[model samples]
Target: MANRVIIVGGGGGGAILANLLQPHGFDVTVIDKSTSHFFQPGNLWIAFKGVSPEKFLRPIPSLLKKGVNYVNDEVVSVDLNERRVTTRSGRSYEYDFVVLASGAELDYSAVPGHRELLERFGDFYSSPENSLKLWNTLRGLKEGSFVIGVADPIYKCPPGPHKGAFLASELLRSRGLAGKVKVVLAVPVPHAYPSKTVADILEPELKERGVEIHTFFTVNEVDNRENRLVSLEGEDIKFNVAVVVPPHRGPSYNISPAEVKDQSSYVKIDKYTSNVQGFDDAYAIGDCTNAPTSKSGVTAHLQAEVVAARLLGYDARYSGRTNCPIITDGKGTFVISDYDHPPIKVRLSRFKRLMEDLFVATYWSAVKYPEFWSPIFKAYFDATDEFIRRGEGW
Candidate 1:
């Protein structure tokens, strides 16, 4: 009998895992609450560059590979001892191996009155609808202080808030309103990015762009009436317009007898193997794992490959390597990170831009329309293997 592998989410990681395993004759089942799968990185472009959200969304049912069971329901509970999961629809599933890619939740209520503040502010980091809405808000703004604040330390995209600030600055400059606009970015971290190497490059670029950076400003509340962000230390920063990154947390059902979860409720997994602590037949990937890396789609993509290989009884392991291109006025700065090393900035060029664009299209096509992207992905996969072997050199 085939090994029954039950994946708890139909996200980027879970979907990729299903596609890889089903071809090897494993019984793969993916359960998710959403019927649509979205290209999340595209949300950044949609917010500032007016990219249509439709181009980034694909229905989940149309993307899954053949021979994989799809369950569209909410997970009720997971009994790790029994190796079983129950859904809100009264269905139960047994699994020989379990992969948790349930992803994270945006907690608007993490800060008091923050959800209400969404009515007046332009937020581009949460959802597609909000990103599109932010586009409209940007268009209507003439001249004022535009502030981008990080509400939490552990956000989905660590570089996203700075990206929004850069794009907005470019937009304001194009409109000849750069002198009239005050662009400020407030981050909870001491630096804009996680790495000092990337931060060194960004700090100078932000200064040249006339944008202000506020470090160590942990936003704890939103004063919508006054249009201000209040920090935990009782400090307040005023703004005419705001784009806030809300707090993130694990799913509500992240409870069990298993002691695999961390204090933040994320599954505690080995950084190199993606193995859930104390669970041999279980693994966690994506934003659900406390892997000491940015919780972005690229990280999830790499982790998916590692988890898939591990399940096939191979010796593959993840190395905490991923890259993100920070776009400013259609120009980009590529940031690459290797295991246990700080991210370094790579020089940008037309070739790098083309490579970035190709990856977005090829990756989505490989997962969403495999029949069309199979031949292309075969070659792309070869290149990716070479890149991985070379430690993701630019």
Candidate 2:
């Protein structure tokens, strides 16, 4: 009999791992709360280009390979000692190995007045509804201070706030309101971006495009009554429209061996091995894991590949690979990095922009049919590796 593998949360990491392991004879089952799997990166397109939200959504079952079982229910808790998962529906699943890929939860209520502000101004960082609402808000705006930033430092996609600011500036420019609207990006970090190498390359580009940057502007509260964002540093930024990425926390459910998780509730995993600390049979990946890397889908995708290889009895370890695509002025570039290297300074180009746009169309296939896409992905990664090794900087 094949080893039973129970994966919690059918997000990018979970789904990819299931598809990868199922064909190799693992009895894989994926449990998720939602029936639909969202292509999260597409949220930017929906907000900036007015793309329909439906384009980025797919039935969760459809994204999983035929052999993998899909449980459309919420996972309430996992008993690590017993190797059993108990769902909200009162069903229990026993597994020889388990993986957590539940991703992070966006907590709008974590910040004072943020929930109310989100209701009024909307943001593209969270859900499909909010992205659409943000599009509507942007579409109607003729001119004013458009503030885009994060309420917390440790949100998914570290570059998300910058991406939103860039896209918003581009939108205003396209609408001929560039001169009237001020695009201000206030981040909690001390630099323009978390990666100093990427920041060095991007800061000049931001200046050329007339984007204002505010570093160390950790948000204290969204003063909806005053129409300004109050920072922990005691500085206030007024805006006609403000969209701050809300704080993020770990899984909502309980995990046995409470010490397995950190204060933030993120799974405490061995960074290179992807093993949940002190538990060899259990692993964690994606936004849910406290990996020393950016919380991006690419990180999850690579980690899924690593975990799958290890489960198949092959020696594999994650290198903390992360790729974040940055789009600005109708062009794009990627901040690619790993444990051995800092982010590579790639030049912005139309080809990179096309690649970024093309991923949306190919994302579902990449997850559902990894066997077919693996070679292509390997080649892509190889090319990126070569690019990085050459010390290509712009």
Candidate 3:
């Protein structure tokens, strides 16, 4: 009989792992709270390009392989000792191996007055409806300061706040409001980005585009009454329109032996193997794991590959690889790095921008049929490896 594998939270990592394992003699079941799989990267396009959110959504079942079981229900808890997962519907699943890919929860209420700010000004980082609302609010803006920043330092997509600022700057320029509206990007970090190499390359471009960069501006509260953002540093930034990426936490489901998770509730996993600290039969991936890497889909995808390979009895280990696309001035490049290296300098180009846009079209297929696409993806990764190692520009 095949080994029974139960995956929690059928997001990118869970779904991809299921697809990769189902055909390799594993009985894979994926449980998720939602029926729809959202292509999260498209949120920026929705906010900036006015793209419909529907274009980025697909049924979760449709994205899974036919042999994989899809359960649309909330997980209540997981008993690591029993190797059983209990759901809200009172059903229990026994698994020989389990993987957690629930991703991170967006906790807007973590910040005081933030929910009210979302209701009034809208935000792109939350949901599709909110992304659309943000675009509507932005298109109507005639002038004044347009503020974009992060409320928390550890939200998904480290470059997202900067992407918003850059995209908004371009949109305002297209709308003939560039001169009237000030694009201010405030970050909690001391640099424009966490990676000094990448930050150095991006800072000059931001200045050239006339974007105001405020460093060390960690959000303390959104003062809706005063129409200002108060920072922990005691600085207040007034804005005509604002969107702050909210705080993120791990899954709400209770995990037995609370020591499996950290103070932030993110699962404590071996960064190399993704094995939940003490349990070799269980693993965690994606934003839910306290891995030393950016919380992005690419990290999850690569980790999924490693987990699948290990489960199939092949020796595989995740090297903390991540590739995040960064856009500015309507062109794009990537921040590609691994445990052994920081991001190599890559020049922005239209081809890279096109590749970034093209991923949207292939994302579903890549998730649903990993075996078929593995060769092609291997070639891509190999090329990127050579590029990064040689310190060559693309």
Candidate 4:
């Protein structure tokens, strides 16, 4: 009998792991609450710009391969002793091994009257149903000061909030309100991003657009009455628009900080193996793992390769090396950045850009036109057919 495995969370890491492990004949089941798989890295870009959630979002069935089972369900808690996962619907699953890739949830309750603001103010960060909320709000606004800020320190992607601001700035400029519309950013970090070069580059980018930058400011609460966001120091900044990035926390409530989490409550795993401390059969990946790298698409894609190799008896060690091409509207250059603490930034050179373009071109092609005969790119190729061969839950 094959090893029975239950993988939790199917966004990036879980889906990739399921796709790879299925071909190897493992009895793999992927469980996630949501019906769709989101390209979250693209969500930041979708806020101001026009990118339908559907264009970026794909059905989970399209990604997994044969031998992998897909469950449109939620895992509420895990029993470490029994090595079983219990779902909110009261179903239980026992597994030989488990992978936790349940990505972070946006905590809107952290700020006062956040839900009201999210409904009224409209943020880029929203569910698939409210995808148009931010864009619709942006389109209606004729003139007003926009205040964008961080809700807390441990956000999913550190560069994304800045990305949203950068994209928003472009929107304001194109609308001819660049000078009249006041834009202020309140960042928790001392710098805009981890990279010195990118931060240096961003300073001019914001100043040129007449946007003000505030550093080391923590948004304590939102006073919707006066339309001001008050910081811990009691300083208030008014805004007509607010794009908030809430802090990220672990999905598993049962796993304690000492056992499975780091200081920030992110899953603690061996950076090389992605194996949780003291748990040999269990692995955590992507935003769920403490990889000490920027939580982005590139990080998840690379981590999938490492986790895949480990499952295949290859004993591959997860590399600390990583890169993400941060692009704005296909016109400006895509800036690349890496690391966990303070991101090490890189404006991707010609070689890197070519590689990224090739990767994107290949990735899109791989899904649409999978070359079963191709030797070089077959390993990375993925399609919906892979899961159909196994079984379709729907």
Candidate 5:
């Protein structure tokens, strides 16, 4: 009998794992709360650019491979002792191996007044509704003190707050409000970005655009009444327009399972292998694992490949690799790095735009075009990247 593999959370990692394992004859079953799958990376585009959120969304069922079981339900519990997973609908599934890819959740309660403040303020981190609302709010603002705040250190996308500030600056400048508007970023990190090499590049660009950077600003409370953020040290930063990234925490099922080690609500796993410690047949990938890496989709994609290889009887170890583009106004820099090496910065203004256009086209094609396969799309992406890298002569 083939291995019965159960993958929780049909997001990027779980969806990719299902596609990879199904071809290898594993009976893959993916469970997700939402029936629709949206390209998360495109959320930024929708918020900053004028792209519609509908363009990035597809039915989750359409993304899965043939013969793969799709379960649209909420997971109630994971009984590691019996290797069983129970859903809220009372459905139980026994699996030979399980992959916890059920990513993190935003903890609005971590910062007092965050939830209530969002109703009147603005944020475009995850929710589509919030992204659209933020865009509407941004378009109407002609002049004010725009502030982008990071509520915690372990939030998704370390560069998100920076991008928000940069994009806002561009928006203000384009509207001829450069002199009338002031932009400020309040973050917990000691630098604009975690990677000092990348921070050096971004800091100057921000300064050039007149965006203030307040490093080590740990926001403990949201002063909604005063339209300001109060730091842990009791410092206050006022804002006319506020956009914040809320704190993140892992799913509760893993902690309640009593099988996996919990590292501050995240599953404790071997950083290199993604194997859940103390478990022989269980693995945690993506944001759910307590890996000392930025919880970005790129990291999740790389970790999924490692998990997939290991399950197929190969010695695959997760390489702490990340490649993220800090794009602003159709152009920007690329921050690429691995665990063993420091991050390398590359600026390819035109190439970045070209890649962005090509990706959106290829992404939707992969969904609608039957012959435009993922493997083929990947080959095209890899070849185009190499071609551009060599063409730039960097």
Candidate 6:
């Protein structure tokens, strides 16, 4: 019999793992709580502008193909000793190998009144509700200190909020509302973009967008009392609308303190194998683990490939490198990272920069759109879905 491999949390990693192993004749199952898959990388874009859900998400049922079974349910607990997973629906399933790519949760409530802050001001880093909230806020906002602030660092898509600023500025200009909107970006990081090289090139673009950059401004307290987001410096930026990007933390489930985890409760896995510390058959990948990579769809997809290979008894030759073209109004920078080195830098043409934005738009759309429906989405999704699909004749 082929090995029964169960992957939990059908993010980019799990979804890709399923496709990879199906052709290899192993049994694979993908389980996620949410009905739709989202291209998470696009959240930054969607907050400022609008993108169709159809272009991104694909339903699991059709996308799972013939051999694999798609369980559209939340994973509540995993019995690693028994090699079984219990979904929120109260059903338990077994597996020989388990890949944990459950992903992280947005810590919006880490800030008080954040739920209301999101409802009134909108937060771009959380869920669709927040995105839709941000969209509405962006539409009606005019002529006030419109602050895009980060609560903390370690966000999934680090370059995302800046993308929000870029697309939103273009949209506002297209609507002739550019002069009416006073935009300010408050970040804990020193540079507008993390890398100094990219920041230097894009600084002018930000200035052109009427975006005032504020560095070293950490959010101290959000006073819904007066509808103001206060900074650590006690300089209150009263806002017509506040777009908050809350903090991110690891998965909090089925975890024992005995097992290794990061300070943030993120799964601690070895760099190459992605195996949970002290456990051989159990593995975690993507944003769920502190896997020495930026938590994004690209990272998840890359780690998923390695996880699938390891499950199949191959070395899962993850050379530990991935390249992402970060889009910007200026000729954007290429941010490439590998295990051995820091994120590399390359400057691309203006046209190529535009292509990067388009590619990212298509890439992070799965939460609401499933993988099976759209051809463009399917092409990008199929490029990575590597897992064993449950099939006939064992």
lDDT of each: 0.80, 0.89, 0.89, 0.68, 0.77, 0.70
Ranking, lDDT, top scorer first: 3, 2, 1, 5, 6, 4
On lDDT, who's better, 4 or 6? 6
Q: What is residue 176's positional error in candidate 6, in angstroms?
A: 2.2
- Report the lDDT tens digits of candidate 4 across residue range 1-394: 8988888987766776777677677899999888777666556545677677675677877767756788888887776657888887888899888888887667778688777788885776656434467877777777878888787877666666666776787888788888777778888777765555567756666666677898877787877888888787667788887766766676645663356776666788888788877788888888777777767655665566677678778888755534445444332333332232233333434554465556554553333222231334333223312322332211
TM-score winner between candidates 4 and 6: 6
Better of 4 and 5 by lDDT: 5
For candidate 6, the TM-score is: 0.85
Clashing pairs in 1: none
Candidate 6 regions with alpha-carbon error over 4 angstroms: 232-235, 256-258, 317-322, 329-331, 357-394
Q: Which stretches of candidate 3 lie over 4 Å from their true place?
A: 390-393
Q: On lDDT, who's better, 3 or 5? A: 3
Candidate 3 per-residue lDDT over residues 254-296, each given as its tens digit: 9988899899899999999999999989999999989989999
TM-score, every prediction: 0.91, 0.97, 0.97, 0.84, 0.90, 0.85
Q: What tens-digit string does per-residue lDDT give for candidate 5 at 1-394? A: 9999999988877888787788889999999889988777676667767579898888888888888899999887877668888898989999999888898888877789888767775467877777877777778777778888887788777777777888878878888998988999888877988777788878888888899999888888988889899987668899787877888888876334564656557888898988888777888888987887778777777677788889999998866766566766657666665566566666648677576667557754443332336466457446535534443313
**Per-residue alpha-carbon lDDT of model 1 for 1-394, expressed as tens digits?**
9999999888888888888788888999999999888888887789878999998888887778878899999898887779998999999999999888899888888888788867665478777898888888888888778888888889887778878888888888988889998899998877876677678867877878899999888899988889899987667899888877888887668446647776677888898888888788888899988898878777777787788888888988887866677766555666666566556546555676677688787766567544455456447545644554655444
User: What overall lDDT, based on C-alpha atoms, would model 1 receive against the true structure?
Assistant: 0.80
RMSD to the hidden true structure, all candidates: 2.8, 1.4, 1.3, 7.8, 3.4, 7.4
Give one clash count per candidate, in the order shown.
Answer: 0, 0, 0, 0, 0, 30
Clash count (model 6, backbone only): 30
Which pairs of residues collide in model 2? Answer: none
